[model samples]
Target chain A: MADPAYRAAGEGALRIEPLGELAAIFDRRSQQTHLVTQPMPEILAALAAGPCDATTLAARLADSFDLDGEGDAAAILAERLDELAAMGLVEPV
Target chain B: MSTIRTLVDLLAGRRDAAALAPREWDGVIAVARAEALLATLAHRLSGAALPQPVAQLLGDARAAAAVATAQAMWEAEMARRALGPAGVHFVLLKGAAYAAADLPCAPGRQIGDLDILVARDALPAAEAALLAAGWEWVKEDAYDDAYYRDHMHELPPLIHKLRDRMIDVHHTIIPPTARPNPDAASMLDRAIMLPNGYRVLHPFDRMIHCAAHLFADGDLAGGLRNLWDFHCLTRDFQARGDCDSGTPDGALGYDEWLGDMGYRAKLWGLGPAVRRALHLSAALFGDEADYRRLSLGDRLFRARLLARDDWGRETRPLLRLAFYIRSHWLRMPPLMLARHLWTKWRKGRGAAR
Candidate 1:
């Protein structure tokens, strides 16, 4: 419950296309296209390597995204991962 | 009404969605819903310009379609697992088949029932396997069940207790008692295996099946969507060069292959249906170069296809009733149809009493 590990589906499961500002991700796993705005896309991209817990995923994401947020970055990213899992784009490991 | 036509034009990519006024958009939505093609129209108009409400509605429809498609595929997977132990390998049919094969008609296609075809000999086994896997009989009436078993091509419909989704196990495409019967065993023999451990009819069989379903088995209900499927599938086949033997006819080589491979022996007497299917598709969706003339009956059939009004309701009551009678007529001989209707009417009267 604290920092659940999550795994994005294997390659070719999600077809990510950039649409101007919002990114359109066609999740072949779910066959649902989601128009996402921010760190959600980055989180799934980071998880593409393999399954990892929230803190580790946050660390992986920090290389590209600044993790200096008022609310904890790991905490926020964990919520986004939960959201993605709800959408069936990522699975809770 | 013109609303259905607008919806079709939008789907055929002839009419511009952006140019539609707000009032016309409402009618488009209504007619699309009536024809059970909202998701398909949504996919057709996706990412294109749209009114705010229309876009929102279509976006929701797109999401619903995704869920429907996933659920459909899952049902197929479950059926596969269930039938595997029973030694019955089922071939996915219609929308399920299209989605599994990722056909051009698949995107945002609304799938209701999960249809599969097994060998006629395997009907009992397939029904047993499905029942064992939580699929329960939908009709408890003895007459209904017996009628389906005896006269229909498919087993009486079964619904999974948990999923609430229905499945139709078919041995053939149309009823045995119907006017035009297709050869199902040959289709099963020619079925192609997908990587996902499922099977679909061969491309040619799929086309023939669609045409047969539209022109032979059914009345003109939902004809537009079926015709669109025919159009898209034909275009997809052409794009993939399934018929690119540089034939002088400039028609699809598969059309000739329908002869060359001697599929004619199995096509029964469906030659006119296939011809009419192609003519209707070309007339509706093709450009001027591809246009084909329609017969007087074909014109009326087109009217039946577009008989919905602006409020998502069927408008032509008399025409609808006529087609309903015609469907039953085509489904059975005069004597059998009379008996079937009389029994049904007696039951209705008893219930009313």
Candidate 2:
């Protein structure tokens, strides 16, 4: 089987409010306001573009933002994807 | 003026933050926090002139309340989703209801638990649905659970295992054993369904429920915040000429509205409580047009409602104890109250030991 793909929740379900350096995501499903810093919001925004596997998502992030530690970037991103999944913000596709 | 009074005055818009010493401001802020009315005061006095520190505190209060509102609404949503498909009808009650309808009392209002009123017959299904949705019993003691089931208006409180949020599923607004029994069936009959699939009580019923919660069911602890909710809700009605969805055409006065043969017959056996609530509101918020001379009992009630010292500590211990007993008295018969307290004391001792 190919690598598992994850998708961020649709626009209507999650409301993103910028809080200075961080962002507050009011998830309507969980009724939780998640205060997330950089890379998390950026990852969610990237996922919002479309569902993708970890490697593809890492490349998408790399194309625009200059990511730290380019060699293990996908590995770092897969961990973050797991975190978002646990938060119910992202789901396996 | 007393700090509690000053706080209420500020909250009610009868007084502004004009010419206040920093120490006095500190006292007022303390009292407001004690009453859980800080965010409300912040919202009410948002545009008024204020000290820089006080303004910053109020701004923080507003932010905290926003988070609270979101949590409370989310809890309500979860409850609805849990109970909806089971064909159980529940109208949101208290602060959750206000938040759902986005009423005047919604903004900056501190919410505790999700209170939803279901029909007496829907109790079993509602409880089962909630349990299946990961809600466990909050009351473990057999006696308290039995008391809740046998005498109280609601189920033994349920706390979700995952969310750690509590929900009170009520078949009526007040306890069945209480003297004043507001018609839950009729109130539910008059409930309006919002676009979001949540239901709210009619405007008048909402005020009546608030008044009952303050006087009949509770000991007037944190009564100031409850009274402020009553004030905001009533003022919103009076501002809009009392032409709520309940009264499509402009009604005459609250008296006529309550005395309406149709309403009185179907609901509102608890009209006196609403009357007292309005009289107290008028007296406190400076609505002289509707104010009445408060009876001695009413005066004591007001005193209890405003029972706060300068440092935000609760004052009037004797009065507090009396009202606490009175609340229990109102909940059940005298003998039952005594027995219940005895059992509770024994249970508490057993647990401590």
Fnat per candidate: 0.23, 0.31
Index of the highest-lDDT prediction: 2
Q: Report, for every candidate in turn, its global Cα lDDT versus the true structure.
A: 0.81, 0.82
iRMS per model, in Å, is 5.3, 4.1
Candidate 2 colliding pairs, count: 0
Per-residue lDDT of A81 in model 2: 89
Error of 1 at B246 (Å): 19
Q: Give lDDT tens digits, candidate 2, residues A1-93.
A: 255789889889999899999999989766677888888988998998999988889889988898777658888888888778656688776
TM-score, per-candidate, Cα-based: 0.76, 0.81
lDDT of 1 by residue, B28-91 (tens): 8888887788999999989999988889999999998988799788678668757887899889
Per candidate, chain B TM-score? 0.92, 0.93
